[model samples]
Target: MAGNWNNLQVPAGVRDLLPAEAAALRELEQELVAFFQSWGYQEVLTPTFEFVETFQAGSPAGDEGSLYKFIDREGRVLALRPEMTAPIARLVATSLRREALPLRLCYSARVFRYEEPQAGRLREFHQAGVELIGAGGVAADGEIIALAVETLLKAGLKDFRLGIGQVAVTKGVLQDLDLPREAVARIKVALAGKDLVGLERLVDEYSLTGLKRRQLELLATLHGGKEALEEARANFIQTGAAAALAGLEEVWQALTAYGLEKWLFIDLGILRDFDYYTGIVFEGYVPGLGVPVCGGGRYDGLVGQFGYPCPATGFALGLERVLMARGEGQGGGQGGYLVAGRDLAAVLRRARELRRPGVMVIIDGESQNRQEAAARAAARGLALVWVD
Candidate 1:
């Protein structure tokens, strides 16, 4: 029993995808790949693991604890990639250095993060997204968000909203507070979690007054559409956040051109966990899910950390989260051939003949006759090809 238990179970925070689930995932990936390609984004792949430094350059200070690390052959540190953006940045700086300006790259791969597993959070999960390298400004940001919305729609998610924000605005507002580093960090945590009570407590602790208190409170509580952005601009215009708000305004205008206003809203409080985000950032949400289905933002500084300075922006969708949001069931319950016969070669030939793209075919020589073959096919949710 112990041996059986050991063989049958996978580690926590990871799961085995049954055939149907795997098929569904493959179909989703293919559809997304096609959609990305249609947008001039070329697919690129990277190693599942890279040197720890690669990720550290893009992740935040305390994020190191989440990396799955180990020692390498030469006694150097290595870690499975927690995300693809940094690795792709490394690739662009080294291999694709000479690639023309405005490289559009996309990838669909598994990312590992040593975090507690929850309803939508997993230590090991799949992420698919794009990197629009060497392109900066509102057009790129708008395109990335547009692509994300369409991708979710492609995945069949009907009810969702993407909240967009400018980290520059958030950072500007924080810098204007002139608070201690520790205090600022705490305020950021509270804002990111939308904990207004904690934020109020912090304001009380710091003896914040007037505009400072109002700014912090607004950052924590402000959430809505265009009116919300206008409200933010009014509150932040006199502070350091004015420029960022202007930049966000341009991006918002561009997004409006895509007719995506209904799918997006402005949330100045949307501070992504990654420290690499230097400009616009956004996260997609589905009702009833505890996590964002997808997220990413501009990291113009990420590639430059690899010694090639460039502007870039992109987003990534969590495949499992998307599937969970869409409530997709295991697919492929029918339309497969189960060829069975008395002669082995005949069954093999029939199975081969039945093979085609998107079709599943199985050979069954053990069936005694057509009746047995039919029963077997029925049991397996497949069609029978009785050959004698």
Candidate 2:
């Protein structure tokens, strides 16, 4: 048992991305960084671990116990960042506070969360994201949305929808209901899960009737094209909901101007999953993948909680999910020369010349006949056999 334990295995929800996966991840990061740079976004790096209180100091409810918390030598709670946006907000607030307004920053980072391990979910994951701080309104919102679409499209994912929503729509309606925090929490959870059935049951249990009932029902189905928006406004748009819809319309128009309307969608069903999202909330979904490949939205008040307020919007693209969605490339090919020669110098020289950085190269001692060399190379899936 001790020996078996010594052999080792990775913990659940954490993984070792093998060579090919690592290569693909690196390629994705480079392509995304280039894209962000082209858009005038400068890359930034933040600490992997941050003071836990810094997160709690956020404007909204933090990720809660999801943080991977630990007691450091100082007996203070420190945690692996659960997400980048908060830390980036802290960065903008403390260090870059006096820099300027509307800072365009990008980052490639590893975020940790203690969660159940499943397809598309990990305790540790890679997120390539950008943060546009000190920017507000539809134009800024539109820019983030457009950049998100371009980033994913550039990453080679064509089959996906940008599910758009305004948190205020949901927030507005919930506030109108005057429901207790517990019921609202339940409804939000159900809505986040897209469990209309559960939402309806909660509705009945809560005895919600009239506009409130209709409002919940409306949210459940408020996803699709612009037509969904029209329907939302016409039938169930509450006083506050109408204002939220108008803001959404402005962003929709901006997305149209960016020539990205086809990818645009209405997901009014979206809940205030994060309290910081005072305006737009969006997520990217691809064919056959249940988890979102990328997601973010405007959190206009988060930085202020860091003691420096700014309007900001951005999204994080998950490499593993994106790779799964694209379902292509990053595969190793069998293109190499297996050099079998008696002359060590000659064999080494030939092998060095034939070896491309990413390609495989094998050289064997003279004792191994060409046939044996060929067999060895063949075992490794190397196709070409060169005998020196």
Candidate 3:
């Protein structure tokens, strides 16, 4: 029976893109891939799904529940890729291990995660990003951040801020407090969320007074330009935070040299994934967007989990989120030409001749006359070509 046919719709957290939306998405993807390639990053493609362990190797604690898992006939657990970085890590450790020390790879692919969908959140989404493998220190970190800034600009996003941070500094300062692991975890949540009230409560609950309470509070409030780093240095100079702060300082200097610091700021609390990111992490935020449009950082230990140890830094731009920020429909109108005529041979020849890279040509099949063809072309937002 055809009963309940209307109920057969896509599941929650996923949506289909119409023609204009699809075209816009492709255009952005092409632009980003070309830009990434210009920076010496070669593109790579990984499987849509990988062994469950691959994602687990880099995902944050408690994030495993978001994976969409299934067992194959071989009884091996497999899941859709929740993110590109982890899959790329697996790719590098095995296939590209013998290639070179610093491998710059990029990807444009779909990622799946099981989660409640909301604004800027989706179960299935597309991400375009790059990873610099086998590189360590401030230069690699600087390159990633600079590329991120340039990417947002290239995507036509004029109003955005890239907040850079060092997770190690946060870890170091928290460690010095000598708090229990669970307590440290709770405090990080508050700090990451910028929940000042919750942070204060946690401080009170732990009886953290004097410099200890102040230092913890600093992580939540320390955000701005160079002065933020200065403040952090003053407060954390004697602890392990010193080294991380020094590294971050170098990265900041490098970005300033790139003349891109105008788009950047220092946010020590920007711990993208406390467990996955080792040092120098950043997230891009637009004024009205409630979620980060893009984010990434150095993971010096991620590749190691795949049996090949190497340093890596990268960032991913949410294709949907970036498109939303640009506020553009980006229809299929650009370079679109509709060749319409009653002469089938002429129409076919003209279409073939007009078709080329970056140009779309469609031959009229249903249009009986020039008027009809023109209407059809206008409807699709294409330039009309009438052949008598």
The candidate maximizing lDDT is 3
Residue range 135-250, candidate 1, lDDT tens digits: 99878888898999999899899899999988887888899889888898998889887888888998999999998888887877788777888899888886667777887888
TM-score of each: 0.94, 0.89, 0.95
Off by over 4 Å in 3: 329-332
Candidate 1, residue 370: the lDDT equals 89
Local error of candidate 2 at residue 257 (angstroms): 3.7
* lDDT of predicted model 3: 0.88
Per-prediction CA RMSD (Å):
1.9, 2.9, 1.8
- Order of models, best lDDT first: 3, 1, 2
Give, for candidate 2, the lowest lDDT window spanning 10 residues: 55-64
Which stretches of candidate 2 lie above 4 Å from their native place?
A: 1-7, 57-63, 235-237, 328-343, 346-388
Q: What is the lDDT of candidate 1?
A: 0.87
Q: Which has the higher lDDT value, candidate number 1 or candidate number 3?
A: 3
Among all windows of ten consecutive residues in candidate 1, which has the lowest summed lDDT? Answer: 326-335
- Please give the TM-score that candidate 1 achieves against the real structure: 0.94
Judging by lDDT, tell me the better candidate of 1 and 2. Answer: 1
Question: In what order do the candidates fall by TM-score, top score first?
Answer: 3, 1, 2
